[model samples]
Target: MPKKLPEVILYTDGACRGNPGPGGWGALLIWNGKEKEIAGGNPQTTNNRMEMKAIIEGLKTLKRPCHVKIHSDSALIVNTFTKGWIDNWIKRGWKKSDKKPVENRDLWEEMLRAAQPHKLSWFKVKGHSDDELNNRVDALAVAESKKF
Candidate 1:
């Protein structure tokens, strides 16, 4: 019989005070029914970077391999993973079809590598919703941004 993998649930969100200003990333990790919050910020960054960082930080926190469900409000993050954008990026040597440089390629590559070890699924959640955990994460992210 194949071994059973533990289930891991992650909810992530990112906020940018300005497109290229202070930005924050938030994440919620749930394993074995216990929940943990992870969040951070950068003084000069974009929303996409924050979204990627949220996932990277959450994955880094895991102690062992597990099946992971990632929920994020950013369609860019969710769709990129789900629609094979990262694979295409790698195949093109990190350049887009139009031959433009991939924005945040470094973080996107890191996110892809971090996800490689797990059975992962990406889900989209509505931002600014009333979901308690999601709301908490957003608040935490915003608060963290103020420190930068």
Candidate 2:
């Protein structure tokens, strides 16, 4: 019988004072009863970019392919993957249904590459909610944004 792989749970958040201003991202990764926290910021960027960056950085932490469950409050990120927008985007040469180029193709491509090694499930959580992990990452992201 094949060995069972352990599941990794991740919670991520992002914040920006303005749509195109100082932005930050935070992520919490849990695996095998252990937890890791990661965060960073960009001097000038968008909230959506920060959100995707959090997921990208979180996935980069794994040493090997594993079952990953990613939880985020951003509907953009969740829906893009969960609603099959990503697959169609690739098929349509990175253009949206409106025949416009995807706004964050670079980040999306990076995310796809980072995610390729694992079996992933995306979950959308309510932002500013009572979920402890979600709140923690949100706070972390907000704090990071304040640094610059």
Candidate 3:
């Protein structure tokens, strides 16, 4: 029989002081009843970039291929993969319907690479609600943004 892959649950969030200002990303990884948290920030960036950064960083932390379910408050992040925005973007050579270059293509490409090794599913969690882990990562992101 084939071995079952391990399972991981990841929660992520991002925060920015302004549309294009200091920004931060946070992630929490849970596996085998343990947890790992990571966060970082950029002096100047957009909230979308930070949101992508959180997922990218979290996925990069896994040691090998696994089943990973990612939870995020940002609809952009969740829907990009879940609703097939990424597939169309790739089909269109990273251009939107209006032929504009996709914003944060660099991170999207990097995230694609980071995620290739795992089987992933995306979930959307309401931001700033009663979801404990989501709220925790949100706090982490907000704190990290305050540093810059």
Return the top candidate by lDDT.
2
Off by over 4 Å in 1: none
Report the Cα lDDT for residue 94, model 1. 91
Please list the residue runs of candidate 2 whose C-alpha ends up more than 4 Å from where it truly belongs after superposition.
none
Per-candidate RMSD, Å? 1.2, 0.9, 0.8
Between prediction 1 and prediction 2, the one with superior lDDT is: 2
Task: Write one digit per residue (lDDT tens) for candidate 3, span 98-139.
Answer: 999999999999999999999998899999999999999999
Q: Give model 1's TM-score versus the native structure.
A: 0.94
Q: What shift in Å separates residue 37 of candidate 2 from its native position after superposition? A: 0.5
Q: Which runs in model 3 stand beyond 4 Å of their true positions? A: none
The whole-model lDDT of each prediction reads: 0.87, 0.95, 0.94
**Error of model 1, residue 105, in angstroms:** 0.6
**Which pairs clash (backbone N, Cα, C closer than 3 Å) in model 2?**
none
Per-residue lDDT of 141 in model 2: 97
Q: Total clashes, candidate 1?
A: 0
TM-score of each: 0.94, 0.97, 0.97
| Model 2 C-alpha lDDT per residue in residues 1-148, reported as the tens digit of each score | 9666679999999999899999999999999899999999999999999999999999999999888999999999999998999999999999999999999899999999999889999999999979999999999899999998
- The worst-scoring run of ten residues by lDDT in candidate 2 lies at 2-11
Report lDDT (Cα) of residue 11, candidate 3: 98
Alpha carbon deviation, residue 67, candidate 3 (Å): 0.6
The deviation in Å at residue 7 for candidate 2 is 0.6
